[model samples]
Target: MIARIAMLFVAAAPLALAACATPAGEYPSLAQREIERVGMVMTPPQTTPAPPPNPTEPVLSQARELVESVRTAHAAFLASESAVRSRVAAARGATAGSDAWALAEVALAGLSTQRSRAMVALADLDRLFIAASTSGESTETIGEARSEAADMVAAEDAVLSELSAQLAS
Candidate 1:
């Protein structure tokens, strides 16, 4: 039993040594391969080139369109207000309990509601302009639009106030 164990150890020793040894070839040693792999991992990766800047023409055009839309809405509101005023004026001499006076009252109420809606719409447009300006859009166009919108909104407020006073009287 002792002789058999010695023979087995002698046979396995050469196999174990061979496993630890690198075979003779063109391939690099284990240490060299590890160093190369580590170098590759430690090195920074190459970056891609950046894209060109965007054109401003489209942004400016869109802002102009929005401004035009606000102008159109403002004009429509003014026309409606004028028509309502004419109706109210025509009914001015009617008795309080008469059908004409009641119709005029209804028209006044509707005008007040419409005025509120127009104010809200103008506010929403203001918010949109502010957002566009803050988000790096073309500031020149946006500034002009904002200025115009502010003026329109102020005029609308004045007209609405005057209408309210008229309705009271």
Candidate 2:
């Protein structure tokens, strides 16, 4: 009876843990979304847009908006991978057959398509930026901005790689 109860507890624990995930992973709060919306557009735009519905908050800075629109959909994928890694580490001693491990695996798989989409977006973004130099901008100015963008891409790639490893394990 004790063995059976232990098995039942093992089986139910992943679900219990999952329930504890309130915000789950890196979902953007409305404010983070707005801040992220603004911080990204350090580059000056070629043209100004028309008036926004809320003068208080432009939907996003156009250049930053463009960058994020390309970059951030990876949140779901990265966040799931992060969650799984944490779960696996937490359940490190469990049997391979345990429900907790299986739950983590399932969550990882659910995020696969989102990962693929994010990769495609990143690739497309890279391609678009290849000739991103504007005539008015000095070469140093364009180079600096591209360097900054490259840094951002590299950081994101590192996160994605860690996530991929967790999923693989």
Candidate 3:
């Protein structure tokens, strides 16, 4: 009985030691290994810094220029409409289908064509303003651009109303 007990104790001792031993290639202490790994990971990377963002002034300037162009086109339309009105007024006392009346009619047709072209220009400017608003522009800059666009549109509406009144008269 004593020999069998001694044999069992010898067998269990080797199994217990094997269970407690660290695996091959593994660190002896888990906490120390984790601390060392975290220290390594905490070091900053060795890459160059990024460049600064581009300036927005140029974008704003371009938007302003586009607004000016729309204003100019609107002014031209107003001038052309005024010219048509003047021609019509001059032909008022003349006979229908007379040379002066015919001339006035031709001038009015030309004004229509000019007005169509100006409208196309204004539409393009509107597109530019929308693009400026959506292109990652600063909010303040976009607000200024929007305000300018609104003022221009109001001016355009006033001019159109005046033109309508002239035609009605």
Candidate 4:
């Protein structure tokens, strides 16, 4: 038993000593200096490159799209209203506010407001576009573009109101 214990002690001694030293204690002053030197050299990032904005080459302005979509929907609602009217004409005492009628009402009313707001926004955008164009181009070209935009805006408004009254009825 005594011989076996002595052999075990010899084997464990080298392993215990090898495990005792850490990297920091290998060169204490140099390790601390190295850490401080690195800390001094380190910095938070300074420059942040911005992400690319959405491409606007193909699509119209957001306002223009909104107005156009609403206008399109308004036309569809008018057609539906006319169909409903014809159906009621065929059958007397035909009720109002059926599911289809309600859907038409909601769409027409909600989209009317949206179209109006969008039309206003589109007007502002057109003004801005015109101003920007004028800085580089001729007055005649700007005038033509402005007139086209005005006509589109007028058409949207007219259709929206007509559909709105149908919804109310």
Candidate 5:
């Protein structure tokens, strides 16, 4: 019984020493440390500026030139308007396709040709007005010039209509 007890004690001593020899894992610290406070900076937003106004002198000069051209054409048309009116008056009672009617038609054609000169200038004005409008430029002066030329053309059209009516009757 004594020898058996001695052998059990030796076996227990080795198992206890093996348990103590095994290593343990590392642990985290719970102590508090100093902290730093950071500040946020901001910048202003950027914006685009409006465009500058364009110069008016060049446009005004071009408008004046175009208006002058219309006036010249109008003057030429007016010079022939009286002659055409007389021809139409003489053919007022003539039969269709007669010599008088043919002469009146020729006179009317001449007047129309003269009026076409003014129309050409008016067309140019229209082009300028459109270009200015599309390109974001000012169109007031161009519009005024176009209006004046249009009025002259309208007057010519009225005269033509009157003469045509007289000839038709």
Candidate 6:
């Protein structure tokens, strides 16, 4: 009889513990339950409106001017492109320091000067980009202008290199 009673108690022990344990889905939430009782509505933060756009900003105008200068220089370069190429072609078989070679060298120098003019404008645009970036201003205009000037200068460099190679040969 004592063995039977021990068996019954052992079988009932888990049932008693299960009664004390709460269900997983029945736990209490940590969220506020009575915010309305405080009688105040929650409001989002207010933000300031943006300023109106200005078309005459000095930095933008300066960028425009610099880009225009690059274009002008590029135009000048194009104007002399044919003459320089002719001189280089003429000097193709000439000995070093001969008259033809000298003329070719002068033509190359003139072309390089034009390229330098565009590069100088590009350098100014670079400075403007740095200044705008450091001062928390937008650098889009300056960057665009710099790209244009750099492209023009690169094209000029290619032409100069080709002509110089011809003259050297």
Local error of candidate 5 at residue 125 (angstroms)? 0.3
- Distance (Å) between predicted and true CA of 91, model 2? 4.0
lDDT of 4 by residue, 50-130 (tens): 996643332235435544554554455445455444433343332456765565655555545545654564566566566
Runs in model 2 lying further than 4 Å from the true structure: 1-66, 74-82, 95-97, 131-169
Ranking by lDDT: 6, 5, 1, 3, 4, 2
After TM-score superposition, the amount by which residue 77's alpha carbon in candidate 6 deviates from its true location, in angstroms, is 0.3
Q: Which ten residues in a row have the lowest lDDT in candidate 3?
A: 160-169
**Candidate closer to the true structure by TM-score (higher is better), 4 or 5:** 5
Off by over 4 Å in 1: 1-58, 91-102, 109-121, 132-138
What TM-score does model 2 achieve against the real structure? 0.38
Cα deviation at 134, candidate 6, in Å, is 1.2
- The residue pairs in collision within model 2 are none
List TM-scores for all candidates, in order: 0.54, 0.38, 0.44, 0.34, 0.65, 0.66
Query: What lDDT score is found at residue 7 in candidate 1?
Result: 100
Model 5 TM-score, all chains together: 0.65
Off by over 4 Å in 5: 1-56
Ranked by lDDT, the better of candidates 3 and 5 is 5
Indicate which candidate wins on TM-score.
6
Worst 10 residues of 5 by lDDT: 32-41
Per-candidate Cα lDDT values, in order, are 0.70, 0.55, 0.65, 0.55, 0.89, 0.90
- When 1 and 6 are scored with lDDT, the better candidate is 6
**Tens digit of per-residue lDDT, candidate 1, span 1-169:** 9999999999999999988898678675566565477556675689998995674666566666766666776777777787778767867767676777777777777766655654665565566667766876656666777678768777877877776566556
